[model samples]
Target: MEAYLAWVAIDLVIPNPMNPRRDHSIESEQMQEILRSKGWAEAITCYRKGQYYIILSGHRRWHAAKKMNEKEVPVYIVQAPENNAEELDRLGSIQGGQVDWTPYEWAKYTYDIWKNSGKASYSQLANKLGISQSLVGSRIRVYKFYPRIEIEDKLSNGMYSLSMLDYILKWIKRVEKHHFELYQSMGEELIRKQMLKKYENRCFNSKIAIDNIFVTSACSKDILEFLTDINKKLQDCQFELELLKVDNEVDVTQNKLNVKMIIDEIRLIECRTKNEAGNLKEELNKLLKEIELKENQLFDMVEN
Candidate 1:
């Protein structure tokens, strides 16, 4: 349908809300503040084909205008579909030209609309709102995992970040599916301790590698801290492993030494060990060969 803009009088009895999209809490507060601070009122637009439909801008403003019991608010009327499906699809694409929302805000907004519409693609929804598809997907995933109470509290308090929500969702999923039994059996304290222990070990290993590569003024301090933390973790893991160890008599000292040597060789940059380094060495060699093949193909193309 051809789109045209027109102003419509504010009606209290107008049953259809401006947008079906909820999480309007943020928008409502923002619009109200803007209007009160500016000491001005503005026109809201509605799309009309047969019955009047609000479109484009002033969703929050329209609500505020209603609350204030204002008469004949100016509106830019545009032509839009009257049917539910078409109207929603159009809403998904339509830019209200309102203030730019943050990633979290946009995620929540887009997620609701997408959930309701069940027709908008991730790319289409994100593109319409000028956000990344991954972000849209991540938000939807977060919404799926997080309890409504937590999300509402976070969003309301403005303590929410998309990254934080992403992490929380991941943690929730991990706790729910993989660790639920363990979490229940071991209790929250023990689970937390194990998580912290694992994190410390990984951090220690990463830091050791980094320190070996780079030299800096604070390097000593970092290394000392990392070593201290990692040593504690190592002690814990060692104790745990010792508890689980089985009493078996096998002469494997030579084999253990060989494996350690192979691990050392993998850490080296220049050395290439094919036979001596075992499966890890073989995997590395294969990866290097694949990289070389790709490089050769690129070189040939350039030469041509």
Candidate 2:
């Protein structure tokens, strides 16, 4: 059937509720820019309701035209097979196959059509959409495991692709299935990065291995800090021990010199300088006590 080109009021073309696409911000902006430079050249597809129109495609263009305050939009109005759930499903599949639909978006739409169109009957429908039955099944598997949206624009948009969504789904399932308890709170993006890195390095074969590697990387920080602290303390103690050893050698040498001087003074003045020798002995005792105190402190540190 040939679609006739015509202009319709932008408000009359309603967005489909069955459409799984949540964010059209990027597309809308691009459309608005295109409208400014070239106007709405590519027509949106739609079908007539009694007083309004229902969109099968170009919801983003419709929205962008409205934002531009355009009174009407160019459309390819499919007049037949009008407004029913089944018809919506058919056109929706048509819409889903467009280049703009991300993997999750495609899967979500296909999964819906697959459910409502009846499973046994959807094989032909799948072929009509240029998609294989098993491919549709894989897409449905990807769709059913869709992750919770944190609603950040880029993250949320990127998550709709097959790889990211599949990783997140598998990550969560693997965590639960394999009992990787330590990684339950890790962010999806971080774990995804770790998986990609390990996969590239060929170091990890499974999600469990990925989780173990991530935990090891995380704990390596604490391990490094503990080692650093122990090394510093040991170095400080060794320096003190060396300092005390040097002090002990100086004390012994000084005492020997003092005793020799006292013997020379006794030989010349008949033991007149005995008090000087006693004073030198007292100084040596003080130095020895200081060394003993320092050694005790080092011992205490080691025991603790």
Clashing pairs in 1: 5-77, 6-76, 6-77, 7-75, 43-74, 44-74, 44-75, 45-76
User: Estimated TM-score per prediction?
Assistant: 0.47, 0.49
Stretches of candidate 2 above 4 Å error? 1-3, 80-98, 121-126, 132-134, 147-304
N/CA/C clash count, model 1: 8
* Native-referenced Cα lDDT, model 1: 0.54
Clashes of each: 8, 0
For residue 54, what is the lDDT in candidate 1? 50
lDDT of 1 by residue, 1-304 (tens): 5554444567622423535335444556666778778844555545654555554555667777676667656665666565665555555455334444444445555666676667489998778658788877877876665555545555645555555556534543445454455446556444434433444344323232222122222233332343335344433433434443422213356656876886797677454576555766678889789769978997998999
Most accurate candidate by TM-score: 2
